[model samples]
Structure formats: structure tokens, C-alpha cells
Target: MPVFGIFVPPTIKRLRTSLYRDALPFSKNLRLKRRSDVDPMGREVSSEDSQRYCNVPNLIISGPPGCGKTTSVWALARDMLGVQIKDACLELNASDERGIDVVRDKIKQFAARKVTLPLGRHKIVILDEADSMTDGAQQALRRIMEVYSSTTRFAFACNQSDKIIEPLQSRCAIVRYGKLTDKEMLSRLLYVCSEEKVEYNNDGLEAILFTAQGDMRQALNNLQCTVAGYGKLSKEAVYKVCDEPHPEKLREMFELCVHGEVFQAFEIMNDLYRLGYSVDDLMSSMFKIVKQIDLPEAIRLEFIMEIGKCHALVLQGLATRVQLAGLVGRLCQTQSRLASD
Candidate 1:
């Protein structure tokens, strides 16, 4: 929970149970196998997960950006007695050089540095965006973790745990976080609006929520920018401030695709492209809108898969209007085939 506000999810209640359980005592490290299990949020929870994670000294906390992974560990470090969190915790983020050298020099040195702490409270070295670290660095860090298991604890915060090396991941418990619900985000937004005297209409807030896609930091940042740029938060203002492909226009385009109106959909894509939006911007917006729109289940899934392929191409530097046009054409073909069948 931030000093400004709290939006901890229910899955985190289980973590609280683990955190307060035995005050971070490690009886013995579990020699678990290398597993590719997705985080708790990626799949259903098991009763064993709650019990197994409490005593693990090292943790691989994975989630989307702004989902409170880093904050949770900070809160834990703050609550410890007999040591200042600033002194006991070694923090590294994406901006830092996270190569093999840093793991060998910086993190290793931190673990070896002697510091007194409350019994069972080990010094924490937090690596934010651990997925960005090099494989060699992760390998080196895993060895350090094994060597220094008694004196220090390691916490790796990342957006995707799968990128972590298997040997390293095996030694740490995996914790997954998900995006905030819309209702939770809205309540917080409304509170902020009242506190800041920010005038916002429902449509404006809804746009923020849509653009935010469950990331609180993005929502708040967009909200602030909208207020700064427009003096008030309205649908048009938020959209203009954020400046992405508008969902309403994308929805109109998608409806055309559903009816096999290829030229119409391409016209919308061309217009959005001419507005200076990237192909990635349009493809992602299309994907998000497709999830909630009322369409036949088979067609919806096919559309999403095609959009994903186009998005991949966009990421690979083929971010042209041609890719967008091709994606729209594919969606139209699917709908035409479905109608014929």
C-alpha cells in the first residue's frame, strides 16, 4: 500500500499470510525441480502454493508493470526491526547495468557485506525488471544465492518470470500478480478526482480505465496529463492527452471487418495510420476491443490470433499500414467463410 492510496489485490492476502507466518524463518531450502509453472495469477491456485512459498528465502515476483511487485517487498523490508530498510536492502532497477559484471561485483558484494538484523530477518537484495538481466548475469546471481542463503535473501521483480533462467527460478518461489479490476481502479480515480478537485465525467474515466488496462500508474499518469492539458477530464480530452488510436474508431473498423467490409476497415486503418499512430498502436487497440465485443466465439478467437500475428510483425519492425491492412483483410476472410459455412 502506498502512502497515497492502497489497491492491494486479494491474491496478495495470501502473501500477507505468508509474510506474517513465522517472520521469514527458513528452516531448510526446498530442492525443487526446474519448473515452467506460470505464476499464481496465470493459472488456478492450489492450497500447496500458499504453504510452500512462506519459507522460501528467495522470490521471483512477476507481474505487469505497476502491479505493486516492488512495493510489496519494500513494505516487508520497512517492517523489519533492528535494521534500516535502506541499509539492509540492495535495490537495482532496469536503468542499472544488469550484466554478468554487476551480478559478480555489485550484488555479490552486497550479499557478502555484513549487517546485523532481527533474527530470521535477512538482508534483501531486490532486482527490479529481473527479466531484462542477461542470462550470464542470472546464472552468476543464482550461484550467489546458493552461497549466501543463510545471511541474505534475494527478490527478483520482473514482468515475465519465464525469461528467468531455469536454475535460478528453481531456487526461488514464484509469485504472480495481475491487473487491478475496473471497479477498484474507478473508486481510486474518483477519490483522487475529489481530492484534487479534478472535474471528470464518466466517459473520461472510462477512457482512462480502457487505456490503462489495469495498470494504476498508467491510469494516474494519464489522468494527470489529461487534467494538465485540458483543465478537465472528458472522453475527448483523455483520448487527446494519451494520443493513441481511439477505441470507438477501432470498434467501427472491427464491426466492418465482421461484416466482410474489407475496404471500409482498411479506410479506417489508413486514417489512423495517417494520424501518425504506429501499426502496433492500432493492432493492440484492436485486440483489447475484440475481447469485450459481442462476436461469435470462433470468429473472435480467430480475429485475436490474427491480430496477435500482426502485432508480432509490428514488433519486428514491420510496423506499416500494410500489416494493419492485411490483418483487417484476414479478419474479413474469416467472417466470410463463417457466413458461407
Candidate 2:
């Protein structure tokens, strides 16, 4: 006969002892305290618990692109969840995975899961570009919000809050983020340069600011591009990255238009276009230059009105070249009329 081996099953008491032993280290690790939570700038930002709206279950943050809405959400999540943030937060881009399916499947599944941490804070679901979701998806989301309000909180970020359903909007605290001020932007740019050890001139910084138009993300990106391409930040490098006409050249084109030199102005515009400047960029630069034009009040007003019309056309999907050429022709007529007067 084959040798027989006797096996003894573990007792409940022994099993329980082993399970507790294995879990002891995990429990200790979970309770380990973090030293400090600081932002990128080394500032001690307030935690979510310290915020007045921490009690709010839902939030809607509306702002222009690159205005720090998403960054603020990240900071808030970090503050609330600490080391558990990555597992406690779900980030979804509505523009990318839009529709009721995502809201029902991914969002619902995540929200229904039991909280893993004992921090007493609800899990966070961040929906970026929230306004991009369809009406039906948004409607479905409203129901999910109701069902899971206790276990999860939502932070919706969008360029426009009006696109969200009224019921959904009413259920959340709406916060509007404004564009960064010139001073704030400049300070941030300077800080970046110091951190990167990149050489930059004031003119170059100003160029980036002007092109960015209060968008911090855009400003930083332009700065990086300028530095990477030129190995130094200068006004010319910034302009090159922006693919914008030089201020002096733009001024020349404006003067040509204002003086009824339509041919010359069109030639300049064509050359700039060939050089890769976008029509939108040209329009923006012209608008700024026109405002500073030293012309009579009536002429200035007329120019503003005409340019405004052209801009509206451009926004309406009119061919850029056609609208720009028409704008130049109108400016020529206006200048001729003013000269006669």
C-alpha cells in the first residue's frame, strides 16, 4: 500500500490568528501619517476640510480654457484624500468619453464601490469639459448624482456652465474661475524662469503675456516653446512660437489700411499668411493696433465698427481670406471718404 499522509485542517481560531497577522502591517501602513501636503509652489494650501464648501456634495467650476479649473480640482482632491487621492478620485473627460453609457457604467461602478479609506471624506469624480456631454447623458448623470450623493461627490469643469442642464446646475455649487491678472501671470512666468534657469527678457515675457491673453497654460507653453526652440527667451522667439506678425510689421499693415493703401496692405497680409500667421492671429493683432491708432475720433470709431463686423464674419465661418480682403477694401473706402471730408 502507498504511504498515507494525514492532513489536518486549520482551526477557526488559528485561521483568524493568521488573517489578523497578515493584515496587521497593512493596517499600520494605512494609518501612517503624511508629513505635509504642499502645492507646486511650496505653499501650504488649505485642505478641503478647511474650505467653506467642503460640505457641498457637488460642484460646478466654469471658466475659460487654461484658467486653472482642473488644477484647482487636483489640489482639492489631494488635500482631501492625502495619500489615497489616486485611488479615491476618478477623472473623466466628457469630451472624450461622452454619453450615457460612460455615466452609467464607469461612473456608476466607481461611485458604488465602498470607500477604502477611513478618512470620512467622500470619493471624488471629476468630469472635465462637462459641457461637452450630450443632453441625454447629462440627464442620466443627474439621476446618478441623486442615487450616489452620499458615497461620492462630483466636480464638473467646463468652459460654459449654461450647456449643463438646469436641474444639474441647481444641484451643485457653481464657482466661476476668472482669468489670471497681468501681474499674477507675470509673477508666475518669472517664477517658472527662475525654476528652469532659463534666460528671459521683459519684452519676451510681455510678448508671451499678450499672446496668452490671461491664459496661464498658454503663457507657460509659449515660454517653454520659445526656450526650447531658441535656447533663450526673447521677444522675437516668442513671436516666432506664436507665429504672430512683429508689432512693427503689424503697425505698418494697419497704417497702410488706414491710409487707403489697399494694395500694399493686402500684400502685407498675404505675405504674413504665407509666412504661417493665422487669420485669427492677424485679426487680434490688428484690433490691438487699431485701438492705439492716432486717428480722429470719427475715423477711429468707423475703423472699430468695420473691424468688428469682419470679426463677426470670421466667427460665423466665413472664409478668412475673403473676409480679410473685404475688410481691407472697406477700410480703403472709409479712409478715402474721410480724406474727402
Candidate 3:
């Protein structure tokens, strides 16, 4: 446990334990791992407080969506402030319907002199999707940062830091977030499963990690989506109903279909369906495949059109398994579909 000297903002500190974890997009297992669990990656920044290092400090978190930028910031705040006034944690999504002026006004009110909370000496602002802000809005934001730096701290979160003005970038201690590793992601998911008393399959767990691509939130969300159908978790059950198909399994299935192993592909789809995979899940897998295959416009259009049909089926309440099986069957037959073109 090397110390990362980045001080947790007080607003995050004030979150109730339950709310903080619930707010996270990860599975129950991963959430549990956070309690008294150590970060094995040793990526913690153990220098001086982030405030001291970043002038007009703005943290630019770049990673895939669901990689925990927003949640991590909240966790940092919770650890710093204490679990009472997490509501004081003001968050504004620059991508939202509210314009920048409204956002600016909200910030002013939140940080106003009369708005004292029970915890922490100052206020914290989390500006989500900061890259979406217009140039005019950013100029206003720059002023806010300077005008209120004494009483407020800002945590700006975005998918890309390059969109931010360089002056703003220079002013903030940029903390680049990486994807959650398999071990860390698994540890969290397992902890949640234990609390929920879900029986899980080892293979299913491996599949989740492989497909999650270092995004803990997606891993957890997919897990929950799959398990919600059965109210119980098991590898076999997960495989059958899983909407987020494992990438490797999906690749294997595609190989079978493209190689004209119709029987084998059908068998795989059947196995997946029997294992509880939904039609929607299978369709989703096909979509991913189409995106990967380096096909000509004619082939791409044919595949996309077929995928669109399956997507429509999923929307029409077709059983998840049926939808998936149908997609695979159609993909296998698509050679003729293209030949007709």
C-alpha cells in the first residue's frame, strides 16, 4: 500500500458506503473488493496532494467508457471528505441538456457562502463530459476556476483530454486512468457475487473478464444483465442468457459460420442458447463480428442489413436465444445472400 498523495475531495468522502458502491457501474463482486482491498497495480500517485501539484487543477481521465473515471473520483472524494454530505458533491454533465450558463449558475449556488455542509472545509465540483463544452462555455469555466479556486475544487472528466484547452490542461494535474485489469476487475465482481449469494461458473467468470476489455463497469453491467433472468448465477446459465457474449466465444462462432461449417455453427448456437444465451446477445455478437470483418461495401451492406433484421427481432420481444440462433443461421446462409447481389 504505497501512498498516493492525491487528496480525496471531501464531497466523495461523505458518501454512504452503500450509495457509493451502488453508484458504481461494476458488478457486485468488484464493489466488494474495494472494501479494505489493496490495489495490486501500485499505480497510486504518492506524491503531494493533487491540489498542490495542479494549478487551477483539472484532472483529465482518458479511457474507454465504463472504466470508472467518474466513480473513482467519487471514491476519492468519499475517502477524503467522510460519509455525510456526498450530496454536496456537485456534478454537471457538459453533454447534458442544461446549457453552460445554467451549469455556471448551479456551481455558484453550490459554492455560495451560505451553503456550508457538515463535512469538509470546501466544495467539490465534478464536471462530467467536459470535452463536450463549447468554447464559450469553457472560457466561462476558466473564469470560474480562477474566481473560486480558494473555496472550491474541480474534477473535470472526459473521454479525451485533447479536446480541452491547453491552458486548462496545464492548470490541472492530469491523472490518466487506465483500464481495470482482469485480477482487479475479477476481485471486485467476486466480492459482489458473494454478497448476493449467486453461484457462478468459473468458465463464465473467465468469459466475463475476456470480454470486459478492462472496463469494470461493462463487465458488471453485463453480468447483472445475464443473471437477472435467473435470480441465480452459474456458468452454464450465464453462457446461455448472456447478452454480452464473450469475445473469444464469439470469434469461434464466427469462424464456424464463415467457414461454411453450418452444422457446427448451428450446434454452437444451440449450445449457447441452451446455456441460456439470449437471442439479443447472439445478435449483438453478430454485430461485433460485422464491424471486425474487413469486407467490401457490398458485403458490409449485406451483413449490416441482416444484422439490422436481427436487431429488429430483439426489439420485437423475440426470445434472446431465438434471436441469436436466427442471426447465426442467417449469417451462415449469407453467402447466397451476397451472391444474389
Best by lDDT: 2
Predicted candidate 3 versus true structure: per-residue lDDT over 12-88, tens digit per residue: 66766658765654443354222123334323421355423232344566556766667656655555455534655
Give TM per candidate: 0.72, 0.74, 0.61
Q: Please state the error at residue 182 of candidate 2 in Å.
A: 2.2
lDDT of 2 by residue, 1-341 (tens): 23576554568659977777544422121221322321332222233544633564588889888766776676777767878887889999999998899998999999988878654588999999999999999999999889988778899999999999999999987888777777867877787788667898889998888888878778877887788789998998998888777777877877887778999988888888788777777778888768765777887888889888888888878847878789888987887787789
lDDT of 1 at 171: 87
The C-alpha lDDT values of all candidates are: 0.77, 0.78, 0.66
Residue 174 accuracy (lDDT) in model 2: 84
Candidate 1 off by > 4 Å: 1-56, 81-83, 259-267, 305-336
Can you rank all candidates by TM-score, best first?
2, 1, 3
* Number of colliding residue pairs in each model: 0, 0, 28
What clash pairs does model 2 have? none
lDDT of 2 at 184: 69
> Listing every candidate in turn, what is its Cα RMSD in Å to the true structure after a full C-alpha superposition?
11.3, 11.6, 10.2
